[model samples]
Target: MDEYVQLLADLTEAGALGEEWRGAFERAPRSAFIPDTVWAPDDDAPTGYERVTKADAPDAWWSLVNTDGVVVTQVDDGRADGPGIATSSASMPSLVATMLRHLDVRDGHKVLDVGTGTGWTSALLCGRLGDDRVTTVEVDPAIAAEAALRLAAAGFAPERVVGDGLAGWSCAAPYDRIHSTAAVRRVPSAWIEQTRPGGIIVTPWGTPYANAGLLHLMVGRPGEPSHGRFVANVSFMWMRAQRPHAVVEPVGVSDHRGPSAMDPELALEDVNAAFAIGLRVPGVRYEHVWDDADPSGTYRMQLSDGAGSWASVRHTAWDAEDAVHQSGARRLWDEITSARLWWLEEGKPDLHRFGVTIALDGAQSVWLDDSGNPVA
Candidate 1:
């Protein structure tokens, strides 16, 4: 407990921690919510539940929860028997604090929390607004049940519903604030419909082409569309429905490829250029392939159906090759090149200045801001 307090104090000392959010962090003990059999990254080990075991050492687990970064708890539906990848998790303390600050919850405000992973965020909301004024929804039934128990144990139990959070809990309509811990490509209409006209809804929104960013929107009216601007950069697990199907490797492409002797700086520049292309043309798919045995590789970007583009930069600068295969309405590689050239001509501004505008239908467009206006 003392270590946890120190961690919170250190985070606050850094600009990342929010001052108003310390109370919630101090009150919630993350170890109480984490299951005994949690995934550990080392050796893919699954440590059994033991309240006083080394795995639960205050310095070890609490350090992870108290950081400003994310901590993955489950992956691939929690069926992972070992340390694999984290598909879901209790978001990091700093991010939680940031979101709470963005939420601006008041004493009596009704708040609806989406994606109650461990119910920790809901517990914090309940602490601020009272349990009766908070409601949280989780799609996974088992997770919801576990979160309910943890919240109850913390004495901040709120209404925990087991269902798709995409369909906002209408039973408690007209909430003063609607905040989602999940990343969603589409802003559901139900959220707009259930939030009060003046209420705020904040979520991470982006397509597979780019990392999601924080979107802050306000409910316009009961039947009207909500509008808002991108607030900050963030990344989150996609909503269950939005998760993509298994990616099929392109036919005639060998998984084994050789490493490129190309300059690391040049490779990074090209990768950044590809990202710029993705920004200009959303929904385009790309992959970078390299093998340890070889010094040659290819960067493939699929623009649209049947249009496969390949940019192969070999070990030698003079042997670099850019191939375009287009059988569609738009050539993706050309768009990428154009965007890259535009960036070069414009002095290559930082990517953080990019902004997004989300419409009522959940359609979002990223723009490069110039003098406070979207130029692209």
Candidate 2:
């Protein structure tokens, strides 16, 4: 515990935490609000966690709370106790600080915080702007109850509402700053209507193919809507109401098999390829599969869309050629290859160089280099 406190202090000393936010983070220590039991995030783990509880492993729990990693609070939307899927968590300190930095908060400003989570963020805001100046909207009633209790216990009493975060807490309209913890596919109109002109809305935004990137909108006055470019690439869980429908494995119908066109290596090597494809391939989600245990010595990439379009490409380490198969109206592999080639033509711009604009009519346009040239 002593070491963790010094670690937090070190981050502030190193300028990772803003001067204005350092004191706030110190005042509302993350440890105070964390639950006794948390599922440690493990991407490689099939279940996604190895539970660490205070009562069972006090040292480990303390170490995790004080360290710089996520502490999962809920699994499968409050079900599947053994971590079938992590639904909610206390984000790593660095991510919290990064998003807060993007917020660029100031004193005496009214802030609306979406997705209360553990209420630690609200407590930090309360320490900076006073409790009356911060309002947090939470969707889960039980989580809200516990978080509100902890917030009050920590001597911070911010307005805590148990409602949909997408609604933007209408009672607190015209806020000076709006921050969303959840990732969004598009900027909600309520968030726009509730924020005053020139206000900042910071959130991680992603697409159906890939869930990564931050959307920083410096809203303009009425008749002008909001527009901004991504400042970083981040993968965050989707906002609950905005989550996409599940994509299942496609059953081969014999005719679904076909010949290969492009090398699977070409599409897989570039990291930002997924982000570039998401902008071009609407309503499509792709999954990559690697089986170390398979005796066939093969790996695969599968693509699917809501309209029953599906495709697969298989590669064998011992073989020279990769096999490709398509079954539906859309040649999913072809779409991926085309998108990758276009991205290359555009100089393979980084995700940060890409931008998005929400026009007055609610139409969203993605661009590269200049907002005038829409990508899709």
Candidate 3:
């Protein structure tokens, strides 16, 4: 208990854990939830626990509880031996605290916690609002069982369910607050449907092209889509069903045919333009790789599909000659160039000005505001 208190102090000083969050940390000894064989980045090597022999090595396990980063416990339905790929894990203590702070959980608020990884967050919620006032859901049965055991060990057991967190636990409807631990590309209708009209839903969201930003949306009418603004930048694994297909690099660039391209300076600008265009036209996937080799180097732009579409500019040290190749989806490149031109013409507005609106019909649109009117 003393060790846990010291750890809570360390996390509080680091701004990872708040004074209000200290009670939850004290109630839940993170060591009980974590497995014996856990990966510790602080140690020179990975550490394993002898659960049966010395199950009471409080210091060894407690040290791991305080480390940053998610701790992987089970993989492949908990069937794989050794440390399998961390399919799910208890989120970092700091991130958990941050999310809770954003949630603004009060004494009597009813909350729905989605993606109850390891039940640590569930325990925290229970510590705040009492066990009966919180309901948590997890997709994996094995993980849910482990989390339940851990929560019970901490003497703060909440209602735990094993099912798709995206659907949410409607049995506990009209929650004061609904928060998801996982990143979502689209806000699920079920979440808005279950939340009270004035409740809050905080989750990470982004288009296919950009990194995710934390979105704090207010629940609107029963059937209408929620509205929100970007709060902060965050990264999390997409929901299992929402994961995008693996991207494949293009093939046979030498065989592609196209017109002579422009100089490398223009090509660099074109790549930047492509990214900006993606902001306007979502689902356009592209990658830009730059190579350094004397005056002559390659600038490659490959589409999501394995199609070799690129524009290369080569030159000699003395500026004697330069060759170019422009191939595959020339029109896409044209659109990118046009968007860049628009930005330049408009004083190059900050990307933060862009906002998202989810429609009732399940279509999401990004708008650039100019005096309260959408520009693009």
Best prediction by lDDT: 2
Off by over 4 Å in 2: 41-46, 81-83, 252-256, 265-271, 290-296, 317-322
lDDT of 1 at 226: 62
The clash count of every prediction, one per candidate, is 6, 0, 2
lDDT of each: 0.66, 0.82, 0.64
lDDT for each residue of candidate 3 in 168-278, tens digit (9 for 90 to 100): 988988798888887777788788778888688887665454445666777767567556765555666666666544435435544333433233244235323333455
Stretch of 10 with least lDDT, candidate 1: 255-264
Candidate 2 lDDT over 1-376, as tens digits, reads: 5766787777777667877788888889999899888887666878867778999999888888888888888788877554387777888887888888888887778999998988988898899999999999989887898898899889999988999898899897789899888888888888888888899989889888877888888888888968888887787777899886566665655435555666666765554777887888887887777678983555777778878888778765312343777767888878888988898898888888888888887777888867888897
Residue-wise C-alpha lDDT for candidate 1, range 1-376, written one tens digit per residue = 6766777887788765576667777677666666544444554344432122236565656656555556666766766364344667877776777778878777788989999988888888876777899899999988888888888888887888889999999998889999999987678878887888878998877655554467777777644646665566677888998763332334564232333323323322743343444466555544444466663644333333223433332333422332333334454445555666666776675555555554557555556652246546
- Among all windows of ten consecutive residues in candidate 3, which has the lowest summed lDDT? 45-54
Q: Report residue 154 deviation for candidate 2 (angstroms).
A: 0.9
Q: Per-prediction RMSD in angstroms?
A: 5.2, 2.4, 6.4
TM-score (C-alpha) between model 3 and the true structure: 0.71
TM-score on alpha carbons, each prediction: 0.78, 0.92, 0.71
Number of the predicted model whose TM-score against the real structure is largest: 2
